[model samples]
Target: MSRKDRDHFNLLCDIGELAALVTGSHNIETFMDSAVRLVSRHLKADVCSIYLYDESAEELILRATIGLNPKAVGRIRMKPGEGLVGATFENLHPIRESAAGGNPLFKYFEEADEERFESFLAVPIQRGVQRIGVLVVQHETADYFSERDVMALKASASQLAGAVENARLLMDLYEATGTHPEVQAPASLQFIRGQSASEGIAQGPITFFKKSHVAFLSGDAHRNENFTVEDFHEAVRQTSRQLADLQSRLAERLPESASLIFTAHFMILKDPKFIDRIVHQIAEGVSPPEAVKNVARHYINVFASSSHAYIREKVSDMEDLAGRILKNLFRRGAEKQENEKGKIVVAAELYPSEILKMASEEVQGVILVKGGITSHVSILARSLKIPLVIADHPHLMHLPEETPVLLDANVGNIYIRPDQEILLQFAGQEAAGKIAAASPSTVCRITQTGDGTRVRLLANINLLSELSTAKELNAEGIGLYRTEFPFIIRPTFPSEEEQYLVYKHLFDEMADREVTIRTLDIAGDKALVYANATSGKNPDLGLRSIRFSLRNRPLFEQQLRAILRAGAEARHLRIMFPMISSLDEFRDARSVVDACVRDLKREDLPHHPGPSIGMMVEVPSVVEIMPALAREADFFSIGTNDFIQYTLAVDRTNEKVADYYRAYHPAVLRGLARVVRAAKTAGREIAVCGEMGHETAYIPFLLGIGIRILSVGPQFLPALRERIAGLTLAEAERHARLLLAEDTLAGALKVLETPTSG
Candidate 1:
C-alpha cells in the first residue's frame, strides 16, 4: 500500500482497536478516553476532544479529550445556536472548514485550556427524526480537518453512536435492578390525577419507574466484573449471543410501530465498527473498565458534538446501545428483565405501546411521574374513565412491586407504605364514590310546591347512543335532542332518508318517553358535512345551529320532513330551535317550521298531530325576547354553558380566561331566571341542558331554579340523579334563591355544600 494508504489503513486499524476496547470494557469513561487518544495521535493534532450532547440539558457537554488542559476534560458546555457546536446542533449538520473560525456562529474563548483549537468539526448523531447528540473534534491547527477527514469522521461517528448506546443500556440494566449494589429504594411517592373513566375499585403494589426513581439511587459505582483477557473474550462472545437471543424475543413481541426503534438497537449491538474500536483499546494493555470508559467517552463526545440533526438524535439510542453491550459483556449471568403485566406500571411517561401492554383485566390504575390535565394520556384516560395520576412526589419509584397502594386519582395522591388506617379509610371512601355513582336513579313524580305548581322533568339527548342513559336517569322524556352530531361526523349533510332512519330509531327507543327533536341548529363552531356554512375564523360566533338551518332552508326542510315523518310514530315529539337570540330569529324559524308542517301535510307524510315548537335560551338576546319567545314556543331548554360564555364574551377554551368561565355566573343565572320565569308565566316547560346539568354540585342549584329537566352526558347521570334524589324541592329552591342573590359565585357554591342528608 502507498504510504498515505498505509496511514489510512492504520487509522482504520486504530478505530477497530478502539471498538474492541469498547466491547470488552464496562466503564464508559475509559472507552471514550482511548478513542480520543487515538484520534489525537493519528491526526497529530495538539488537542483532539469530543463534546457530547447532553439530552437532558439540551447542551453540548465535553465528554473526552486528548492533549488538552486536564481541566477542560469535562467542564465545557455550549447552548444550541451559541457557537460552532451550537450552530451545528441547531442546523443538524456538520461544520468544518479552514475559514470556520471566522464565522459569526463560531465563538472562540481565550482561556488557558491547553491550546486554542482553530480547526473544528461538529456533527450531529441522530436516529430517525430525533436528535440525540452532537459529535465534535477540534485541533489547534487551522485547516487540519479536510472534507475527506470530515466524511471519515462522520462515518466513524455513526459507529461511535452504536457503542455509546450499548454502554448506556448496560448502565440502565445495572441501575434497574439491585445488581448494582449502590442503588436503593426511593424516599417517597409521586402522585397525579386522571379522570375516573371506568367505575371500579382496584388495589395493587406500586411498580417504580426508573426515571422517577433515579433521584433516590446514587449511580456512581461501576457494576462490571474484573476479568483477564481470555475471560474478557469469553464474556464478549457470551454477551453477544445473549444480546442476539434477547433481540429475537423483542422482535417477536414489539408492535410494528416500535420495530424500527428496536431494530436500531439490534444493529448497534452487532455493529462491527463499534466492536472493533473497543477491542483495539483493550489490546493496548489497558484495564477493561478503563478501555471501555475511554472508548465510550470518545463515542459519547462525538455523538454529543455531532452537528447533523438526524445523527444528533441518535445519541441517546447510541448510549442505550452502548450500555446494553457493556452490560452483556460484564454481567453475563444477569437475569433479563421485561415489563410484567398484571402489575401496576409506575412510569414517568408511558408510550402508547407500553399502555397497550396492559391487559384490561390486569391493570387497575396508572400512576404517572409527570403529566398534565390536558395531556393526551389524561384525555384518553378521560375517554376511558381510567383512574390515572400525574406529577406526584419524586420518591414514588421506591414502592415495592405488587405492593398494595391506595390511589386517589381525583387529588393525584398515591399512598406508598400507607398505614392500615389510611388504606382502609381510602378504600372506604373509594367504595362510597363508586356506590354513589352506580346506584339506581329513582323514578320520582313531579310534585307541586306547597302552593301546588306543576313541575316538568324532561331529558336532554346529545349522542344518539345515549338514549339508554336518559331512561336510567329516569328522565320524563326527551326534552332536548340535538340533531347535529350526525352532520358533524359525516362528510356530507345526511340525506332526508338517512336523517329519518336515525330519528326513527331514537323515536322508537323512546316509545314511552316524550321526544323533542331540534331542527339542525348547526352553527357557531358546530360544523356540517354538506352545507354552505363555511367555517369562520371564530366558529363560536360564526354560522351554526339555528343560523345554519335558517340559511340553508333546503337542508332544513329536508331535515324537518324527516323529523315529521319520524315523529308521526313517536310517543311524544316536539321541535326546538337553537340560538334564537331575538324574536325575529324565533319568528322566522317558526315560519319555516310552519312551512315544513304544511309541506309534510302536502306530501301526506305522517307526523304528530301538533308537535310543540320550542326555542333554546342560550343567548342574552333570547332572554330579552323571552316574553315573546315564551308566548310562541311550547317549551324552552336552557343551554347554560354557552349562555354564560357568550354573555361574558369569554371563550371557555382560552386558558387565560377559562378560570373565569363559570356556569353559575350571575349574568348566566339572571338570563336563565328571566327565561324560566317567562316560560313559567306562559306555562311552557323549561329544562337546563349543558355541562351544568352533569355537575353534582349544581344539581341542587338547578332544582332550586325550578329546572326540572336535566340533560347531561351518560356517564354523569348517576351522580347527578343521586344528588337530586337526596334533596327536597323546598330546600333546593331556598338554596337557589340565596345562590342567585350572592355577589360572588364562590359564596353561592358554598351554599350548595350544606350537607343535606339523603
Candidate 2:
C-alpha cells in the first residue's frame, strides 16, 4: 500500500478506537482527556481542546486540553461570537484559519503555543439543529485538520451529543431514583389515557424538571474515606445556599400554595441535623462534593429503607427537597438554545416547587409523567387555567432532553417528533378551542323552553376574583360562593372582622344580584392553619364543614356574625352551611344563625335580619332526612361535588378509585331528586353547586330534576345560561326523570344529549 493510504487507514483506526473509548468512558473528565489526546496524536496538532456547551451559562466551557497550557484546560470560556470557537458556534458551521493570529475571532492565546501552531480548524458539533460545542485542532505547519478531518470530527460530535444526552438522563434518573444507568427509551412507542380535568387545547415545547437527589455525602464514594470536618461544613454551606436561592426564586414566581412545597423543602435543606451529618463527612476527610454527596446519599438511603411506610414514601419528596437545595446552590437557569421561542414542557410529573421554578409566560402547557386528577399540581393548574395532562406514558421522559416537543392537553395526547404538519394541525385545533370558548360569552340570555318553567342561571363562585367574571358571563346571581378556601389556607381562625371584610366586599360587588355564601367546609387532610391541630390523619370524616364549625361554637358564631354584617350591606345575601347529615345538624346550625342575628341586634351592630339561610344536601343522611331538614332550613344548595364522593364511599384522592366517583351516577341522581323534591315540598329553592352544574351535558337532567338555580363555574355561566335560555323546563323535567330511571350514567347523558322537540 502507498504511504498515504497507510496513514489514512491508521487515522481511521485511531478514530474508531477513540470513539469506542470516549463513548464507553463513565467519567466526564477522563473521557475529555482521552478524546483530546487522540486528536493531538492522530492529527499531529500541537494543540487540541474540546469546548462543551455550558447550557446553563450559555457559554462554551473548556472540557479538556492536550499539548496546550495546563491552566487553559480548567480556565477557558468562550462567549458566542467571541473567539474562533465561538464564531464556529455562532455561525453553526465549520471554519478553518491558516494563520491563528490573523482571525479577528481569535482571543488571548498562549504565546509559546501560538509560536508552535499556525493553522486552525474548528468543527461545530451539532445534534439535529442544536450545536453541542466545538472541536478545535491546531498545528505548527498552518495546514492542520483538513476538510476530511473536519468531517470525521463532526461525525464524532454526533456520538458526543448522544453520549451527553445519555449521561444527562442517567444523571437525572440517578438524582431522582438513585438508580444508576438510567432506563433506556423503548424501541417501540406506547400510550396511557390520562384523566381529563381542564377542558382546553394547547401546544408548546416541553421542559422537564424531575426531582433530583443530593448525591453528595460523607462516605467512600470513590472507595476512599478522605474528607475533613472543614470540607463538610463548606459542602453544607454550598448546598444550603443553592437550596435557599432556589426557594427564593420560586417564592417570587409561584402562587401562595406553590410556595409551600418549596418552603418545606427549603426547611429540610437548612435542617441543622443534615448539616451536622455533612460536617461529619468532612471530618472523615472526604472532598466537599463527596462529603455532601455521601451525607445526602446516606440520608436518602435511610429514608428509602425506613420501615415506616410514610417515611419510606416520603423518600421521593426528600430527594426533591435535596435537589432543590442543589439546584439553588448551583443556581443556573436553563440555557436558551436556538429556536426556544415557543416550546411546551412535558414531564413525568410536576410539583409546585419545580413548576414555580419555570417562567410562566414561556410555559404554554405541561404534560406530567406522574400526577392525578386530584394532585396538588392539577389543582394549581386548574386555578391558573393552564392546559395540563397528568400521568402520560413513562417513555415521555426518554425523549430528547431540552428538545422542542408538542403537548396536546385537550385530548390527553403528546406528539413526539412532530413535524410542521402535525404542529399546524394542533395549532388550528387549539385556536378553535379558544375561539369557541370566547365566542360564547354573550350567548346566554333569558328565554323559556317548551316546558314553560323558568330556570335561574347562576354562578358557582369560589374566589372573590370571580365576581366580575360572573357579571361578564351574565349570571343572574351567585348560587354558591364557596367560603372554605380562606379557612384552608389561613394560619389561624379568621377573625369575625376579617371574615366580614371579605364577605362585605363580595356582597357589595354583587349588590344587584343574589349571593349564597357557604360556610367554611374544610375537609380533613387539606392543610388547615388551625383547629384539631393534627399532623396527619384521615380528614374526610374528621372535623370539617358544618360539623367542624358547630363543634367549635365560637368559630361558627364568628362566621355567622360576619355573614350578618355582610348581609346588611347588600339587598340579597344568602347563607349556607355544608355537610349536614341530619335534621339535628341543620337545626343546631340554624339556632346559631338566629343567635348571631339576635346578638348583633343587642350589640347595636347594624346587620340585615331574615336573610335566607340554607343547608348543603351533600351527605346521604341529609338526603334521607331531607323533608324535616328542608323545613328547618330556608333552602337547600346541593353540593354535588362532595355528595358524589360520600355516596360512592370513594376517596377522590385515591388514584385507583377516584374515577369511580362520577357525579352523573344513577345513585347520585337519585339523591339529587330526593333533595329537590324535599326542597319543593318545603316551598324552598334548590340550587346545584358542583361539577354537575359546570357540565353542559348534565344541565337538562338537572333542570328536569326541578332545580331552579343552576350554579356553575364562572367560565361556564355564559354557555350554560345560553343553553338554559333555550330549554323548556317541563321537557327538561321529563327528560331528567327518564334519564334518572336509566341504569347507567352514559345512558342518562345520551338521553340528555338527544334532540328534544322544541
Candidate 3:
C-alpha cells in the first residue's frame, strides 16, 4: 500500500477504537477522560481536553483533560464566545491555529499550565443543531496538526458527542437521586430530546393525559347484529358536533392557529375515504368502536410511513381524531379528578383541542412522547406561554401518574424525579421570569435608519388573536393577513357571512392601519378533505393559490364579497392574491373582485368605493413579467419563503434538499433586486412579508435593496425594529451593492458578517 493509504487506514482504525470506547462507557468522568486519552494518543498531542456547555451559566466547563493539570477538570471555565474554544462552539465549526499563542482569541489558564503549547485544533461536538460540547487537541510544536489531522478529529468528535450527552444526562440523574459513590441509575433516566415548541421552565407533579379507552361490544354475528347504518351515522354526527364545540372553545381561549387543529380533526372526521371505510367495516358487522380503531390505525400507519415529514406528523392528528370518535361512540367521558395546581401533564401525543382544554392557571407545563414543532398543539403552547417538552422515552408513558418532575422546555429536557437542588434551581430560574420577559419592550415607535429613511414595520398574522400582540409591538399595520385560515378551519366552505365576520373583526381591530389580506393559497398538500379538493400528485406545482380560486369561481366570489363588505365597515383594507404566476392570473382574480363590487352595488350594500389590490411576488415566473403585472396591480408584496424555494427548485420541506434551500443565495438576492427595481420603475409600493423579513441578519440586505416595508411575525417585531434603527440608508445601499457582486451564498453571508457601518 502507498504511504498515504496506509496512514488513512490506521486513522480509521483509531477512530473505530475511540468510538467503541466512548459508546461502551456510562460514567461521565470516565467517558470524558477516556475520550481525551484516546484523542491525545491517536493524534500524538501534548494536551487534549473536552468542555461541555453549561447552559445555565452560559459558559463552557472543562470536564476532562490529559497531559495538563488534572485539577483543571471541573474547575476551568470560559464564557461562551470568550476565546478560541468559545468561538469554535459559537460558529458550530472547527478552528485550527498552527501558532496558537500568537492568536488574539487564545486565552491562557494559569492552573492548566498550557502556555507552552504552540499549536491548537478544536472542533464542535454537536448532535444536530444542539451543541453538546467542544473537543480540543494541542501540541508543544508549531505546525504539528495537518488538515488531515483536523478531519480525523472532527469525525471522532461527531461520534463522541452523543456519548458525551448521554453520560452527562446519566450524571445528572445520579446527582438528582442523591446517590453517592457514582452509582448510575437503573435506567439512566433517559432524556429523549426534541425540538422546543415553547420556551419556559416548570416543576410539578406529572399527570398522564390520556383519553378513556372504549370497550368494544362483542357477540355472535348471527345473534347480535342489531346496530344499523343510521346508528353509525349518528355517532359520526355526534363526534362532528363535539369537535365543532372544541374548535369554538379553542378559538375563544387560544389563537386561531390553535383552533385550526380541531379544524383538521373536523376534516378527518368528515373525510370521505375514512368515513366510507368505517361504514364498510360497520356493514361487515363490526362494532362502531372497533371499526373506528381499525380504520384509524390503517390511516395512521399509511401516513406515518410517508416520505414527507409534514404528512407523517398528520398521523398524530389522525390518531387524535380516531380516539375522539371512539370515545363518543362508546359514550365514554374524561376521567374526573381533582384539579391540582402546577401539574405537569404527560401524554403520548397532545391534540390542539386537548391542549386548549388543558390550559388553566393551575397547569404548569406539558410533556409529549410524540409531537413536532409545527404541530398545532405546539403553536398553542407557545401562544399560551406554557412550557412543553416533546420526548419519546419508552418509560415515559409507563411512569406513575402525579410523579414529581421538572420540565425545562427552554433546553428541551425533562427531569423525572428530580432531587432537591435541581428543583430549587428550577424554582429560582422560574422566579427570575427570564424567559417570559425575553421579548423586548412594547413601546410604540416608528422605525427609521440613522439617516432618516422611513421603514414601515408590519405584522404577518394568521389569526385575529395575534393582532393584539402586533399592536403591543407597535406594528405600523397588518402586511400579510393569511385568509386561507378560515377555509382551513371549516368543515365546508365558509359562507359569505362567516367569512365577512372574520374579516370585519380584523378590520375593526386594525381600524386606522392598512390591512393587506392574502387570498386562499391551499393546494393538494393542504387541501381540506371536506372541500372536495383533489390531492394532486404534485401538490406544490399543481392547482394552488390563485389558480385554485380562478377554477372555483363561486369560492372566489364569496371571499371577495366578504372582503369588500368588511372593507366598507373599516377603511384601509387591501386584498392580495398569492402565487400569481402570470399577469393573466392577477387580471382574472381582479375581474372576480370587480364582479363582487358590482353585485354589492346592485344589492345596495354598504361598501368601500374600492380597496387597494396587490399580488404576491413569490414565483420566478412573476418576476420575469413583474413590470407588466405591476401596471395592473396596486402594490407588490414579496414572499421570500416561496420565492427562494421556487428559484432554487429546492423543496424547503424535503429534508434531503432542505439544506440547499438558501434564502441568502446569490440567485435569490438578484431576484429580489430585480423585483424591487421593477416595482420602482412601475411606481408601485413594495413590501416583504416572509420568514426572511424576520431574520435580523437579512434586515440590512432587505433595507439595502430598497425594501422599506418589512412584515414579520409579531414576536420578532421588537428585535427587527431595534436592528433597523441602528443602520443608515447609505450604509445599507453600499452593502446591497457589494452583495449584488457576490456569486455564491457563502460570499453573500460573509458580507452580512462584516460590520454594516464600516
lDDT of 1 by residue, 604-671 (tens): 44666577788777888777677777778888888776788888898764545767877777777766
Q: Scored by CA lDDT, what does every candidate get?
A: 0.60, 0.63, 0.72
* Cα lDDT, model 2, residue 656: 73
Q: lDDT for model 2, on a 0 to 1 scale? A: 0.63
Model 3 agreement with the true structure over 455-565: per-residue lDDT tens digits: 999998866878888898789999998776666543345555456667877888999998998998876335554444455777778778888888878668768887897
* Per-residue lDDT of model 2, residues 236-292, tens digit only: 455444444444443344322222233223334434555666666656655445545
Better of 1 and 3 by TM-score: 3
Score residue 45 of candidate 2 by CA lDDT: 74
Error of 2 at 209 (Å): 5.8
Shift of residue 380 alpha carbon in model 1, Å: 12
Model 3 misplaced regions, further than 4 Å:
1-186, 197-251, 254-423, 434-442
Q: Please estimate how well model 1 matches the true structure, expressed as its whole-model Cα lDDT.
A: 0.60
* Most lDDT-accurate candidate: 3
